[model samples]
Target: MAAQPSSSVFLETYGCQMNVLDSELVQGQLVALGYSICQTPQEADVVLINTCSVRQLSEEKVWSQLGRLGIQKRRRKELIIGVLGCMAERVGATFFDRMPHVDLVCGPANLDRLPGLLDNARRNRGMQLSLAGHTSRRSATLSRAQDGVESLDLSRASSPIDHEQGVPAYVRITRGCNKFCAFCIVPYVRGPELHRPPAQIVDEVRRLVDQGAKEVTLIGQTVNHYVYA
Candidate 1:
């Protein structure tokens, strides 16, 4: 096995093509911030789980994953663990209170906050003698908007890192949902429908193609409702 780098991340995602694409974007941004993607949880300086809340079972699995990570965090005080995506938005700040080991809890729309939060975690790791009672302090703040719907604020330059060199990739062209069906949780967790600007989407696709992506899948909860004109 190859030696782990000085700064590394282990990111895992659950549910949907959107979540996978979201993870890719996050990995790309973190890579730009000088973090390499590690293969396992044990080899990473930071571990982020991008969760889903489409069903009760999915959330349960996330909780179980958190329990496992909590054990690892107990052994390594400096390890940064975070929960992101729909589940994080659904639970909000209470997730920090519930899982004291987590360094941050942020929604999909708030991924821009990760770089700053991770930096804070690293800087405070050695300064604090005991993190026994400390929990992630990030709050879910909706600060950006487009057409009255909140923006997801994803990075446009994040091209997928395909192991096959030329595989199909998913692009999140739209996010959230407006229609709240009785059995669905998307609208609650992901919020209202927010479409990405056509220019930005075009640029991202072009970059992905340049990076050897053969095909692209545009993802959204209500893909039929997309109106970027």
Candidate 2:
């Protein structure tokens, strides 16, 4: 791993428990790569927003935050701004075209590439994106065998205890959804359902318990649909 230039990052999450887990895993990855977490966007060299697309209000909030970050970027040319999660997957490259200040946009399924994307964005001052796109059409068996995003969960760092809620943690047993309900965009943006190995799920839960987590929540788009052979 290339040594990151000393920098702090602020990640704001807006979504369900799944997105929360993604944000935590992403933070752990960045922290492992030498990035320090900051409490607010104003104090950071890198700012990322883990977004949701299930509601228009959630997307609007991301746009509003991006606008504020754009103004900040004008003052600090070196600041890096990124959009992650469902919104990035749904919007794809359009985010870069519409929000020129966003240096990086990564889909929920492509989060494993985020660290490299961030590194390139900061070094080259160019746009970087990792969307699911056609890759979402792959067979579940193929995805399970090749998915790099699985590492994001497997490599989770120590859990950070919530001062008020205690050490609450979330573990994703499955991802995406197979249900194509008329009003739902989850099937399109998050892709087909892929279940993690039952063994891995058990191991993750045990690990979280060992890490001082007092509460563990199992999450998924359609959690009950989870199945493994």
Q: By TM-score, who's the top model here?
A: 2
Top model number, lDDT: 2
TM-score of every candidate: 0.81, 0.93
Clashing pairs in 1: none
Per-model RMSD to reference: 6.6, 2.0
lDDT of 2 by residue, 161-202 (tens): 342355688888898888989999998888998888888889
lDDT by residue (tens digit), candidate 1, 1-229 = 1222588899999988888877887887778666888889998889989999887888999899888999998898778888888888777767767887777777776676667667766777521111111122222222234222222224535433763477787777677777989998777767667667677678767877877778988888998988765
| Residue-level lDDT for 223 in candidate 1 | 89
Q: Mind sharing the TM-score for model 1?
A: 0.81
Worst 10-residue stretch by lDDT in candidate 2? 157-166
What Cα-based lDDT does every candidate model obtain? Answer: 0.71, 0.85
Q: In model 2, what is the error at residue 151, expressed in angstroms? A: 0.8
Off by over 4 Å in 2: 142-144, 158-165
